[model samples]
Target: MSIEQSWNRITRTLAEHAPATAKELLPPAAEADVRAVEDVLGQRLPVELFEWWTSCGGGLHPVLPHGYIPYRPIGSASAWREWTRRHGDGPQKGSAAGLPGAGWHSRFVPIATDGGGYDLAVDLRPGPLHGCLFAFSHQWGVAYPPEWSSLTAMLGGVADALETGGPVGRYHAETTRGGMLVWKL
Candidate 1:
């Protein structure tokens, strides 16, 4: 399925079974906002990411609680701001070189944050893994293999997990007693 379709299914599932979490999703971002971040970063967002942001701005709170880390998708502006504020010049401590993992690399776009030092980023670095998604941890750095090849795959996995009660990577979809969606390991 297309990214948009997968996203729709995910949102629909959330709306029906996890209304509280569904309400936390942000509105679509304006075109100008996306452009502004691109201009600032001097990097173009991949088509899938662009499509995603144009349809869903991001999140106001953590929606995907993968394991213990509660990740919330971030808008372009927030991504750029975090890049500037944290990345600075080069890779940080515990960063793996040339790998799209935990580090302060300009090519890595911070698409989601755990509100801690860790992040979920899009790898812009040239290579086979370009455009793939990986989880960046402050302590562990980048996981060897990418979690998702693209935003499309990630959304599709999420939708499938919700529909089948399956696992997305290591995370399993679950609902709280209050009918809120949560992904646990």
Candidate 2:
């Protein structure tokens, strides 16, 4: 199936499971890890989402809903390596599995970069969930997420937020109600 089709299937299915969860939930320390990330970036992360990430039971990488992608630096460039090193990991193989740690590297993207640039709806992965897009938002120290279905729409939201400097890190996640959606950053 096409990436978009695959993304549609997973997201459609995950929508019914909003407030996405994982196998290994986050410990308080892991929450701190996420906080540290925000601190390092001089920005507050999506708290509720981070809370959800920490709630992972330990397997199946905790992920947001469709049309939302994580923003991270991934590359062999000096600046990228320096960025990763600053994050202080020992260097590890990468995986789309659980949230990565030391040694593991891959920027979380709710949208696909496609070697092109933040196409919020484009799924960069070549695998089954390849077309899945994700994003998050942060504003006034609080993050808002939204429900998205297409890359264009997701990018539009992100662009507006960035332009206004109002909020960021908006992402899609499983909700307790029934499914996931793009919400506060």
The positional error of residue 140 in candidate 2, measured at the CA in angstroms, is 29
lDDT digits (tens) for residues 49-154 of candidate 2: 2442243212222233233233332211222234344433422333342221233133422222222222222222233433233321211111112234333343
Name the 10 consecutive residues with the lowest summed lDDT in model 2. 136-145
The C-alpha local distance difference test score for the whole of candidate 2 amounts to: 0.32
RMSD of each predicted structure? 3.8, 16.2
What are the per-residue Cα lDDT tens digits for candidate 1 across 112-183? Answer: 766665667676777666778776664444434477887788888888888888888888888888877777
Q: After superposition, how far is residue 121 of candidate 1 from its true place, in Å?
A: 0.4
Point to the candidate with the largest TM-score: 1
CA shift at 154, candidate 1, in angstroms? 0.8
Structural similarity to truth (TM-score) of each candidate: 0.82, 0.25
- How does candidate 2 fare on TM-score? 0.25
* Residue 174 Cα positional deviation in candidate 1, in Å, after optimal superposition: 0.9
